[model samples]
Target chain A: MKKSYITAILLVVFLLTGCWDQRLLKDVRLLLGVGIDYQKGNKVIMSSVVTRNLEKKPPELISTTGSTPRDARINLQRKLIYVPDASKNRIVMLSEALARKGSILEVLDVFYRDPRSALNAKIAIVKGKAKDFLETQSKDNPDLTAFLDRQIVTSEAATIVPDVDLQSIRTGILDPGEDIMMPYMGLNKSNVEILGGALFHGQKLTGTLTPGETTVALLLANQKNKQTTLTLPIEKGVQMTVNILQSKRKLTIQPTGQSLKVSIDLQMNAEAIEMPFGDFSDQKTVAKFNHTLSEEINKEADKVIKKLQAANCDVLGIGRQLIAHHSSYWNQIDWNKEYPKINITSSTTINLTRNGILE
Target chain B: MGTRQADKISRLELFFFILQSVIGIGILSLPYTVFSESKTDAWIAVLLAGIAITINMMINWKLSSHFPSANLFDFLPTLLGKYLSKAVSVGYIVYFLAVAYLVLLLFGDIITRWVLPRTPVLAIYFLLVSTSIYLARESLSVITRFCVIVSIFLPVLLILMLVPLNSSHFIYIFPIGQTGLEAIFKGAKETSFSIIGYELLLVIYPFVKGNHTQIRKVILLSSAFLTLFYTFLVFNCVIFFSSEELEQIPEPILYMLKSFSFRVIERIDLLFLSIWIVTVLTTFVNYLFAASIGIKQLFHQNDHRHFTLAAGFLCLLCAEFTGDRFLVQKISDFLAKASFLFVAGIPLLLLLIIYMKKLRWHGR
Candidate 1:
C-alpha cells in the first residue's frame, strides 16, 4: 500500500509540471547582432542581424526607429514573422554619433535590466552610422555578426583593442573616477575593419586612438591582452619588429606646487623577432639596442598620454588612484576639470629577453 | 524522552546544521546592505558582527547547559509560570513561522525574477514548502544528515564567487577605515539580521549528546568559522564592486556571476541560483522543524508529522498572500526586530531568573 501510494504521488508530480516558460526554437528568430544609432528628435534607429534559418540561407538585416532601443526593437518585431530573441546575442554596435551624445547608460538600460538579454555580448563603436555598418556585408564573410565578433576577438588578442563586454564595461561607465575605451570599427571598401579604440570621457566619446597608440595605451594602463607587437625604425633605415612578452606599469601621483604631477613607469620584456643588423650575443650591442628601443617607445608613450589627456580620458584610472590614496584632494578638485590640466609624464624600459635563432 | 534519546546526533552533524541554517538568502545581498551604512569599510562591519554573534551564541549555550536534558520549551515553564511560558513558546513558534514565510517569499521572488519569470510564484512556494515538510516531519537527525550531504555545494558556491576575481578592483576597498566607527557599528547592526539563523541552538541543544565543555567547544568553533566565512563573502563583494556601483546592484553576487560566461556554460547566474535553491531548502526546513517541535510540546503529542504539515501549510499560505514587494520588505524588517527578543532577550532573562531563585533558596 505504501509503495503504491508513493508511486501515485510521483506520477502526479511528473505529469503536472506544465510548460509555462517553454520557448521553442522554431517560433523565434535569433537576433545575433544589433546596432543602435542616434537620430534627430531624441530618437534611436536600431538595426539587427536576425537568423531566420540556421542551415542554408543568410541572416536578414532589418532596421527601425523609435524613442528608445527597446521601442525600436519592438517596432522591428512588428515587421518580423516570428518574435526576435536576443538571448544569444553576440555583439552590440553603437554609432560614433550616438556614443558622442553621452547617454550610453540610457541606451544600454534594457540589456542590464532584462534577465534574458545577453550580458557578455561584445560592444563596439562604429565610425559611421551603426545601421549602415550592420548592413555592410562582404562576399567572403557574409555573416557580419560572426565576422565582426571574430575580428574584435583577434584584435583583442593582438593587443590592438581592449577586452570589453556589456558587463565588464559597466564598471568604467558607472565609476566616476574612470573611463572606458571600446573597439572602434570603420568601413573600408565594403569591408569592416577594426580601426582602433574609441576613447571616452565618462559616457561620451571624446576622441579616437590609432592602432599603435591603442597598444601603447593598453600597455601603460596594464590592460594588455595576449601579445604586444611593435615595428619601429631604430635608425635612418633600420626597421625592427619586437614582440613584448611581458609588461609592468606603475603610476605615482604627487602634488607639485599648484597642480598634481602624475608619473608613469612602464617596463617591457621584449623579444627581437626581426632585426636587420643586431648582435644581441654581445653585451654592449644588447645595451645599445635596448636604449634605442626604450627611447622610441618613450616617444610614442608621450604622444598617447598627450592625446588621452587632451581627450580627458582617464582610462589609466588616475582619478581612481587619487580617490584611493588621496581622498582629501580628490574631494576638493573636480576630476573632469583637473584631468586636462594635470602634468602627466611616462617613461619606458625595455629588456630584450630573446633574439631570433640567427642572432 | 525515548524518541529524544534515540535521535541523538554527533558533534559534526550539529555543526553542519548550524552552518547551513546561518548561511542563506542574506548572504546574497549582504555586501550591498552593509555598504549602505559602512561604505568601503563594510568588511570590518561584517567582522564586528561576526564577533557579536559568537558572543551571543555563547550566551545561548550557557543557558542551554544550565538545563542539559531539557529543550527551551521543556525548561521555560520552570522559570516563568505555566501560562506565561505557554505564551512565550507560542511567540517563539510564531517567530519561526514568520522567518520561514520570509524565506519562502524571498525564494519565490528571486526564482521568478531571475530564472522562471513566466512560472507562477505560487508554484515555487508550494514546491519549496512541500519538500520542507517531507524532511521536517522526520527527526532532527535526518535533517542534519541531509544538510551534511548537501554541504559539498558550499565549496562550489565559494569557487564560483572566485571566478569574478579576474575583473575585480581591489583598490575599490581602499581607504577602508574612513567610514568611521559609528557607521561601521550601524553596518554591524544591519549585518546581524542576515546571520540570524544561529539561534536554532535553543531547540537543538537537548537532542545532541555531549558534555557541557565539549559542546561549548563545538559551539564556539562552529560559530567562529561561520563568522570568518561571512566576513570573507562580504570582503569579496566589497572588492568586486565600487561603493557607487554597489549601490545600484541589490544582489551583487548574482550580478557579478551573471556578467561572466565560460566556454561551456553561458549564464552562470542561473546555475548559481539553482544550487542556491538547495541551501534555501535547508534553511526553510530548519525553521519548519523548530516550529513543529513547539507545536508538539504545546499539545503533549508523541509524533510531530501532523504538526509539521500544519506549520508548512501556514507558511505557504502566508507567503502566498504577502506577494507585494513592499509588504515583503515590511515583514522582513519586523522579523529582524522580533528575532532579538526570542533569540537573546528571553534566554538571558531566564538565566538571570534562575540565578536569583538559587540565591533565595540559599538564604532560606
Candidate 2:
C-alpha cells in the first residue's frame, strides 16, 4: 500500500509539470494589424502595426515590400523588434491595385498557414494604395487598425458590405454557391473613410458598390439595423430621412418546375428625421409618407439587386437561401447558371413609430 | 468491506462530472455536423437532444438509486444471469476503451490542425496517456476534486466565446424555424453524439450520495446545463457563419472565433484551443477511470491500481494503432453507437430486469 501510494505521487508529480511551452508576454511580439499593397511589377508591399508601450512616445511604423507576402513578412523581420504573428492580427487591408491584380489570396495564405491566425479578423480593400489607408490616422482614434475594426461591426447597411474576415473569405472562395465581399476604404485627408464595398466573384475582385448602393444592398439582404437611415422623397421637392428602429426580412422561394421565383418580404419600423412639408402630424399625411418611403426604399433595393445580378455577385447569399429553403430545387438547378437569371420580387412595409423630437 | 462503506460523492461533483464528460471533442465538431443537416435550425436540434438526454439521465439515476454503493457491474449481475452480465460487462469495457482511444485521436488531430502541426502523433498520444494514467490512478475523490478545479476554467472558456460576438452576422440566424421539424430532428441526432459522455453516471452512480431526489436533481442540472451550453454554442456558430459556409467547414465554432480581433489579442481561437485541452483531459480521465473500474470488476480485484495502468497502456496502444485522423473518426462513429447501447440501452434493460425480479419475488 505504501509503495502504491508513493508510485501514484510520483506519477502525479511527473504529469503535473506542464511548463514545457510556457511563453511570457514580454517574450512574444504581438501583431495588431497587417496592410498589403501592390508594388511595381507584381511585387507586394506589407505594412504591419506592432503594439509597443505607449509610454515610449509613439512607436515606429515598419514597412517591407516583396514579391510575395512571405517575402515581405521575412523582410519585415529584420526591421521589427519582434516577429509578427498573424494569429492575433486584427485587420488585413489590400490595395485596390493589388486587389485588381488578384493577389489577395496569396497575401492571405501567410496568415492562414499559421495556426495562431484568427479567422475573424476583418479584411478590406482600399481604393488606391493599402498603405495609404493603413497610414491614415485620425486625431480621435490614434490606433488606425482599431478604428477600421469598428466599421465592420457598426455599419447598418446590409450592403454596408458584410465584414469578410479571413475564414469567411476562405470559406466563400472555396464554396461554390457563395462569393466573398470586403469593405472598400479610402484615405480622406488623414482619416480612413469607408468608400463603399468591394464584391468578389470567386477569388478575384469583380466590382464595387458606392455607399448608397451598399446601403441599398444591405437593406435588400435584410441586414438593416436600428441605425439604418432611409432617405425618401416625401413630396415633389421635400426629402425625409428616417431612422429604421427595427427591421426584418423574409425570403420565400417558390419552385415551379424548371424556374424559381424568389419573394422578399421586408418589415421595418422607422421614425422621420426630416419632413420637408413642415409639421405634418395628421394620420393621413403619415400614411402617405409611409407609403412613399416604402416605395422609395423598395426601388433603391431593386436597383442594388439589379446591379448585383449584373455583376454576377450574390453577396446577399441568395444561393445559400435557396439551399436552406428549397433544397430539392437547389440540387436540381445549376446555381451558377440559374442564379443570374432568377426573378426576384421585393415588397416592403414601413411603420412610422416616432418622428424625431419634432411634431 | 460491504457495499454501504463505499464513499458517496456530492451532487455538485456529480453535476460537474456529467458536464465535463458531455463537453468533450464533440463540442468542437457538433456545429459543423448539425449545420450540415439542419442548417439554420441547428440550435433547435441541440435543445431537443437535451430533452432526450434528460429523460435518459433520469431513468439511469432511478435505476442507480435502487442499489446504493453498487455500480452497473454489481447490479447487472443480479439483474441478468452471471454469464449474460459478464458478457455485457466486457462489452462496456470495450466501449470505454474506445472512448479513451477516440479522445486521444481527437486531441492529436486538434493539435495538428490548430497548434502544433509538426509534432509527432506518438508524442501527443504519450502525453495524453501519461496525464490520464496519473489521474485514473488517484482515488475517485481526488479525481473528482481535480475535475472540479479544472471545470472552473470552463466559465472562462465560455467568456472567450464573447469575443466573436462583435463579428457575428445576425442575419445569418434569421428566417427562424425555416428548416422545420424534419430537419431539426435529423440535426438533433447529430448533436446528441456530443451529449453521449453523460453515461459516465453508470460507473460513478454508486459513488453518488443522497437518495433518489438528490440524484434526480444532479441529473437534471447537469443535462440542463449541457443543453444550454450546446444550444448557445450552436446558435453562435449559426449566426456567425452563413448556412452555405457552415456546411463546408468541419469546425464552425473555431472558424467563427477566427473572425474576432482585439487590440491586445489577435488569435483568440489559439487561446481557446489551449483551454479546451483541459476540457479534453478531464473527459479522458473520466473514461480511463471508468474503463479501469470496469476491468477491476471483471477480475474481482479489491485494488484498482494495477488495472488502471493496464487500461491506460491498452488505450495508448489502440490509439497508436488507429493510424490517422480519418480512420479514427470512422472508429469513433462506430463506437458512438456502441456507447449509446451501454449508456442508455443496458441501464434500461437492467431496470426492467430488476423490476421483473422484484415482482416475481413479491408474487412468491
Candidate 3:
C-alpha cells in the first residue's frame, strides 16, 4: 500500500508540473529589430523584422500603425499566425522626426515596463523614415537587422559614434545634467551606413555631428574604442593618419569671480598609421610631429565644443561635473541659459608613442 | 548543558543560520528604498543600519546567554509570569507569521511578474510553502545544513553584480555627504526594516553549542559580513545608475543585470532570480520554524512538528489578501514599524525585567 501511494504521488507530480508557463520555441516568432516612425495625425508607425526560424529562413519586415508603440505592436501581432516575442530583439531604430519630438521615453516606456522586453537592444536614430532603413536590403546579408546592427557596432569600434543602447541611454536622457548621443544612420541606395551621431539635449534631438567631428568629440569625451584613427590635413594637402591608442580627459570647473571657468584637458597617446609626409626616426622630429598633431586636434576639438554648446548638448558631462564638484554654483545658475555664456575651453595633447613598423 | 536540546548545532551552523536569515527579498530593492532618503549617500546609510543591527544583536545575545539553555519562549514566563509572557508569545508568533507572509507574497509577486506571468501565483505559493513546511518540520541542524549548502550562490550573485560596473560612472556618487547627516540617518532608519531577521538569534541561541565568546564572535562576524555585503550591493547600484535613474527603478539590481547579454546566457536576470528564489525559501523557512516553536511552547508540547503545517497554512492564507500593490506597500511599511517594537523594544524590555527580578532574588 505504501509503494502504491508513492507511485501515485510521482505520477501526480509529472502530470501537474510546468503546464502554464511553458513557452516553446516552435510556437512563437522572434521579432529581432523594431523601427518606430512618426506618422500623420500623431500616429505611430512600427516596423518589425520577424523571423520564423533564425537559421533556416530569412526574416520578414512588417509595418503597422496605431496611437502608441504597444498599440502598434498589438496590430502587428494580430496579423502574424504565431505570437511575436521581442525578448531576443537586438535593435530599435527611431526616425529623426520622431526623435526630434522628444517622445523617446514615451515610445520606450513599453520596453521598460514589460518584463519580457529586451533591454540591451542597440538604439539608433535614422536620418529619414526609419521604415526605409528597416526595409533597405543588401546583397551580401539578406537580414537587414543584422546588416544595420553590424554597421553601427563597427562604427562604434572605430570611434565614429558613441555606444548607446536602450538601457545605456536612459540614464543620460533622464539625468538633468547630462545628455544622450545616439548613432545616426543614413540610407545609401540598397545599403545603410552610420553617418555620425545625433545629439540630444534631453530627449529631443537638437543637432548632429559629422563623422570627423564625431571621432573628435568621442575622443575628447575620453571614450575610445578599438581603433580611433584620425586623418588630419596638414599644410599643402599633406594629410596624416594617426591611430589613438589611449586617451584621458579631465574636466575642471572652478569659480572665477562671479562665473565658472570650465577647462577640459584631453591627453592621448597615438601611433602614426599612415603619415607619408613626416619622418619619425628622429626624436626631435617626432616631438614636432606630436606638437603639430596636437595643435590640429585642439582646433578640431574647439569646433566640436562650440557646436555642442550651440546645440545645448552636454555630451562630455561638464554639467554633471559641475553638479558633482560645484553644487553651490550649480544651484545658483540656470544651467540651460548660462551654459552658452560660460567660459569653456579645451586643450588636446598628443604623445607619439609608436611609429608602427616604420622607425 | 543540562538545558541543551537533543540536536545541538555547532558554531559554523549557527553562523550560516544567522547570515541566511538576515538576507532575503530586501536586498533587491534596498538601493532604491534608501536612495529616496539619502540619494547618492545611500551606502553610508546601509552601513549605519548595519551598526545599529549589530548593537541589537549584542543585546539579544546578552539576554539569551543568561538563560543559556532556554529559548525566547521557554524563558519568557520565568521573567514576565504566565499571563504577560503568554501575551507576548502570541505577539511574537504574530510577528513571525507577518514576516513569513510578506516573504511568500513578495516571492510570488516577483516570480509571476518576472519568470512566469501565465503561471498561477497560487501554484507558486504552494511550491514555496510546501518546501518550507517540509524542511521546517525537521530539527535545527538539518535546516542549517541546507542553509550552508545554499550559501554557495551568494558568491555567484556577487560576481554577476560586478558585470554592470563595466559601464558604471563612479562620479554619480560624488559630492559625498551632500544629502546631509540628517538625511543619511533617516536612510539608515529606512534600512532597519530590511535588516529585520537578526532577531532569530533570540530563538535559536539555546540550541547552538558554543562558549560565550565563540557565540558572540560568530554573531558579530555574521552581522559584519551582512553589513559589508549589503553596502557593496548598494554601492554597486548607486554607481551603476545615475541618481535620477536609480530613483526611477524599483529593482535596480535586476534591471542592471537584465541589460547584460553574454554569448551563452541571454538573460542573466532570470538566472539570478532563479538562484535568488532559494535564498527567499531559506528565509521563509527560518520564520516558519520560529513560529512553530512559539506554538510548541504555547501548547507545552515537546515536539514542534504538529504546528509547522498549521503555521505554513496561516502564512499562505494571509498572503492571499495582499494582492493589491498599494496593500503590499502598506503592509511592508507596517511590518517595518512593528519590527522595531518586537525585534528590539520588547526584547530589551524583557531583559530589563529579568535584571530587576534577579536583583530582588539576590537581595533576599
All DockQ scores = 0.64, 0.24, 0.69
Which of the CAPRI classes, incorrect, acceptable, medium or high, describes model 1? medium
Cα lDDT for residue B183, model 2? 93
DockQ head-to-head 1 vs 3, winner: 3
Q: DockQ (C-alpha) of model 2?
A: 0.24
Higher-ranked by lDDT: 2 or 3 = 3
* Residue-wise C-alpha lDDT for candidate 1, range B177-292, written one tens digit per residue: 98889999999998886688878898889888779899888888888888888788788888877677788988888888988889999989888887889999999999999999
lDDT of 2 at B220: 91
For model 2, what is the C-alpha lDDT against the true structure?
0.76
TM-score of 3: 0.97
What are the chain A TM-scores for all the models, listed individually?
0.94, 0.85, 0.94
First chain of model 3: TM-score?
Answer: 0.94
Tell me the tens digit of each residue's lDDT in model 1 across A1-359.
96588558755764565576777888889888889999999999998888866556777788999999999999988998789998988889999999999889889998889888998889999999888777775244555554568789899999999999998787787788888899999888787888998999988999999999999999999987888899877888997899999998999999654589899999999999999788878998889889899999999999999999999999999998988898888888999999988988998988899997977
In terms of lDDT, which candidate is stronger, 1 or 2?
1
TM-scores of the candidates are 0.97, 0.73, 0.97
Candidate 1: deviation at residue A125, Å? Answer: 0.8
